[model samples]
Target: MNKRIFSIGLALMLGAAYSLTAFSQVKPETLVKQRQAAMILQGKYWGPLGGMAQGKVPYDATVVARNAGFLEALSKMPWDGFAPSTKDVKSAALPAVFTDTAKFKEAQDRLQSEVSKLVAVSKGGAEAAVKAQLVATGKTCGGCHETFREKQ
Candidate 1:
């Protein structure tokens, strides 16, 4: 009885582990949806903010603060959600993301870091500084998109 129970327990454990491993692989359709959602949100906020920072549009601290909040939320997204499989890459917003994983990761890190900096600048009580940081952050966004995003 003891031997049979132990064998069953071990099998269950191994099955659970395999299940987890399989779950870590994101489906191609799911990845495409996620990327599309991320891009839309990013565009909604970053495009106007970039214009404001560049002086092509009037700067509004309130808008900047609101957009900064969105960016903070976006920065927290798990990069691992993007699976590295060939099928996932084929459907990815930027197919090159698969071929240049290291560069993509670096760009993602830069984007997150710049977003944090932008948040700090927004709350630091300096208008000019906030604008400058916004520009810097916008550059990082553009840098990543230039390499990873499909031109639309």
Candidate 2:
């Protein structure tokens, strides 16, 4: 009876340990999924806003409002997960992001600030103000991409 009880207890403990290991391993994949979603949202905002700033598309307050909201959300997203540090950044991400942490953080902060400004201007429903904000936002996007995004 004692031997059987000990075997069962050990088996349960080992199973629980294995489960914990599996749970921990799953988190990195979840973070990668989150990062991918953020990238998509970033692209959506960048495309339309860039068009408006470049005069390729007419400045539309509704579009600005919509895109600004997305940008604001993306800007506020936490840079968690295994960010490609200098040691292990994917080939796709620009090397600078891993190599120049301070510059990268500055660019990220600028993006967030500009997006916040864009949201504010969009709320006012003034075309001129919206246009100006869009231009500023585009500059921030360009600056970050130039430094951090891989040239495709």
Task: Point to the candidate with the largest lDDT.
Answer: 1
Per-model CA lDDT versus the true structure: 0.78, 0.75
Which window of 10 residues has the lowest lDDT sum in candidate 1?
84-93
**Candidate 2 C-alpha lDDT tens digits along 1-152:** 69999999999999999999965665545655666677677887778888888889987778888888878888766355425522353434566766798898888788888888888888965887788888888888678777777776
* Model 1 Cα lDDT, one tens digit per residue, 50-108: 88888998988888888898988876564654666533444435777778889989998
Which pairs of residues have clashing backbones in candidate 1? Answer: none
Off by over 4 Å in 2: 1-33, 81-91
- Name the lDDT of candidate 1: 0.78
Separately for all candidates shown, the number of backbone clashes (residues 3 or more apart, or on different chains) is 0, 0
TM-score for predicted model 2 compared with the true structure: 0.72
